[model samples]
Target: MAAAAPALTRSRRPRLGALERRNLRWGLLFISPWLFGFLALSVFPILYTFFLSFTRYSGIRPPVIIGLTNYERIATDPLFWKSAYNTLFYTALAVPIGVLMAMILAVAMNQKLREVGIYRAILYLPSILPVFAISLIFIYLLNPAYGMVNALLGLAGLPSPNWLGDPTYARISLVLIAQLGAGQWALVFLAGLRGIPIELYESAEIDGAGAWTKFRRITLPLMTPVILYDIIIGLSLGLQVFTSAFILTGGGGGRGGGAGPDNALLTYVYYLYKQAFQFGQMGYAAALSVVLFVVSLVLAGAVFRWARGWVFYEAEDA
Candidate 1:
């Protein structure tokens, strides 16, 4: 057994051949730029932010050590709580709605129609446009008076409530605006839909399974993995939401420069930006960044853990 253990170790750590070593060196050389960028841009910044979280750096002056003061203040800060609430609310509503809309569009796009390609292109056009540009366009569209949306509502004899200006409807409007990007995710779903075996549907048909039954049993189960992917990506983007809100709220400047009316559009990342840039609270912003990083990690971990039960993998069953 002792002799076998040595043999096993040697087998596991077998020396690379000359060609293998040469290939490994070439691969490393090819990837050196990415490695350097990752270390300098990502890893160093993350470590520095963690360090700054414990200090009082205002971007102009040297960072002063302040222990847990910034974190402790976070617990008592009303704006912090409000931003957190707004972010959570937006994410909760937006992610599910976005996922569902993407799935619906994917289903529509997958239909065997003559003009399907044109429809798909039109649906996906919004996703290619710059988010800021889309936000600007939405600003005009969602205007309470004379806006196309409000004009249609008025024609229908419905109240044209202020969308971005009203606190009650501000976040909801953002949620609706988020759907414009659903076409991108729809493409992902369309790929998954295409990957589904036609044989499965044929077999279900032979077994006298209705279209709805086949969809519920086979289509949905097979699509679970794609749905899981969409959910995680949506969650991450929803948490980091800023551009739309910033542009819609006119650079987050209305009513005491609160992100929006009553800070309704004051998302967590926007608050972080205000701290780092607008208010010059770099250390506080660093602490906020750290907290956000931790929260994102936790949420992603939780989603992965929860997905184990529902995210069906065909290979696992096979």
Candidate 2:
């Protein structure tokens, strides 16, 4: 009976028509450009970088194999350690602060108003500006003596430190720069906020929940997935922080020699750029890139695992 059933199932299975086979071929042909790009631009470069990490190559000469030397050098380097620490500290401070600010702005923007679109546009404008332009504007704005930021602080009877120049304030200044671009994140959060059922808020109100209670019990719990997404995005961007730091620190001409005072602003990506371009250490740079890729992968996996408990889904409940 089992042998008969197997034969029956095989007889009943449908085979592809000639038209279907033609359609499949055309579909693959249509997407071949993307497939080629994926192989050539993405996959090939990644594999090549991994291969380069084990060899000495200064762009002009043929790569000479030197297994594990670059990795060993990275393990012992103080500047590498400093850059890693700075990158982590920046991500820790910036991601949470950026998430909180974006959430607040999103909640406020979610409210119904006569001219809400105007307010939203104004808020989102900064996020769309070129980073170089923004960095330059902030460089002048944060000038210690006569910049608008210092002048405003002085008016409030607060001392203003040299933002880009002082080692103590440089990273914090970068965090502030991150905040200025919160509009895009806020928009994502706003979409999440809208997706949340209004019935949840109404139910909380029926239970005599106040604003804080409703926010804690209803709003925040539902927003965890959005927060998780934002955190991941922030972490990826923050850990590879370069452009603003590079511009503000005067590119290759800063007090700490491409690093801000005392190497305080020398982020991981900036240090990698220095190694590969400035110092002609391509193999070492490739090792650093690989390390960064591994660390990011681990951090992302940890976050996803941790989120299993908190991130609620309507589909899961259904």
Candidate 3:
């Protein structure tokens, strides 16, 4: 009976007509350029990199098959460990802080003030600015001698440290740099905030809930999905932190160049860049890239798994 039912359902399904087939062909033709670009530019490079990770290639010479040597080298590489630690530490600090700042901005922007539009524009402006330009600005702002940061510290009689020059503060400085793009995530958070039903807040208020209570009980739960998204995105970007570090550390140049003092700013991607371009260890670099890809996938998967416990869907409740 079940088999007959399946067959009946399949038989009832309409077949594509000549006109439908022609439309499908036209649709495929329209998207062929993007399809080719994705295959040629994105998919092919990723597959090639994976293949190269298993071989010894110095770019000029033909690649030689060397199974796991690069990965083995990475296992024992002190710089690899250092870069990994730095990347993780940066992500751990930056993601949470960025998320918090973004949420704050979103809440503030969600207010019913007449100038809210102007305020939002002003706040989001920094997120759109080029990272290179922002890094350059930070270079001057964090200058220990005469920078604005130090000048402000001096006014408050606080100690001023060489933000980029000192290893102890270099990573911290980069974490601070990561906050500049919080406005981008703030926009995502704003959308989530807007999507929350106003009725919930009204009901909370009628139940004698204050702002904090309403936020904690109503806003927070509803916003978990957006928060999860921001965290995943923040983690991905933070793990690949390179531009600001590279720029702040003078393009990783000088005596122990490419890594800031005591290798404080030696992010994983920066180290990979150094190996692939600066040192010409293409095979090792490819291996590093593969590891990063795996790590990113694992982290994203873990976040999604964790989110299942807390992420709320209005449709699910409905």
Candidate 4:
């Protein structure tokens, strides 16, 4: 029985060959570099920044140990509130309008019509334009007197509001321009729209459905996933809007370069940029970044939650 027990054990348990074990180890080893890089670059930096947020550090010098002073200051800071308000305003305005416009353009581009390529090209060109250069062009276009926009307004006997210069219009100008250059988003929507099968639309048409009814029942429901995707992206980008605000609000290198007019166009990221690079308050900026991180996480989670009910993923069709 004892001799048979040893034979049974040997038969039941077979050790991996040295070469196979070596290959397994090497597989893990290959991924270890990526894991290490992710830890150092992605994870550690995030932790370090969160720690720094509680301290005070000018970019030129070492951090001074402080306990929640920056957070406390930000809690009561009017400029912080102003920036938050402007960011929220931008997010609110840009998300729905931009998404709707993008979807509209995408649907138009998806039609089997002549010159569709030209239409698509023209629509997407603005997205690739240098943002700063686009802002410069818009600056001249929105100029009070000599601008073409105002000139058209004058010809129509309408009042021309100063776009970048006026407090009332400053934030709206950013929102408007963001909407205007939604070409990239349009392309994304176009891709999603094209992915929808023609059979469903044909079936709806065969059922004697009207154009509006067919769209409402087939197009919109199936497109909900893409719509939700656009919402998440638009919210995140709009909340962090910087380039348009930076150009309109006088660049972020000095205190004078705060938001335009009454700080109407100041976004969360623009404020954070001003704090870190311009004011050299790296700690406060880190704290702001942390806040932004939390807010973004929350927003993303909310979108996912809402999408669970609203969005019709491809898997749902199966």
Q: Rate the local accuracy (lDDT) of all candidates.
A: 0.89, 0.87, 0.89, 0.83
RMSD of each: 3.8, 4.5, 3.9, 6.2
Give candidate 1 regions above 4 Å deviation. 1-14, 252-257, 316-318
User: Which of the predicted structures, 1 or 3, would earn the higher TM-score when compared with the native?
Assistant: 1
Q: Which tens-of-lDDT digit does each residue in 92-140 have in candidate 1?
A: 9999998888888888887788898887888888888899998999899
Cα-based TM-score, every candidate: 0.93, 0.91, 0.91, 0.87
Residue range 1-318, candidate 3, lDDT tens digits:
223222233556666768668989999999999999999998999999999999999999999989999999999998899899999999999999999999999998899889988878888888899998899999999988879999999899999898888986999998988788888888989999999989999988899999999999999999998999899888899899999889987774644434888898889999999899888889999999999999999999999998999988677742
lDDT of 2 by residue, 48-71 (tens): 889999999887798899999999
lDDT at position 35, candidate 3: 93
* Global CA lDDT computed for model 3: 0.89
lDDT of 1 at 152: 94
Cα lDDT tens digits for candidate 4, 1-318: 223222233556666667758978999899998989999988998998999999999977888879899899889978888899989988898899998899889988888889988888888998888777777777788888888888998899999998777876888878878876788889988898888889988988888999889778878888888899889888888777888888865574336536777888777888898888887889999999888889999989998997898787666542
- Model 3 is weakest, by summed lDDT over 10 consecutive residues, at 1-10
Indicate which candidate wins on TM-score: 1
The candidate 2 region of ten consecutive residues with least summed lDDT is 1-10
Where model 3 places Cα greater than 4 Å from the true spot, the runs are 1-15, 254-258, 316-318
Q: Alpha carbon lDDT of residue 118, candidate 4?
A: 88
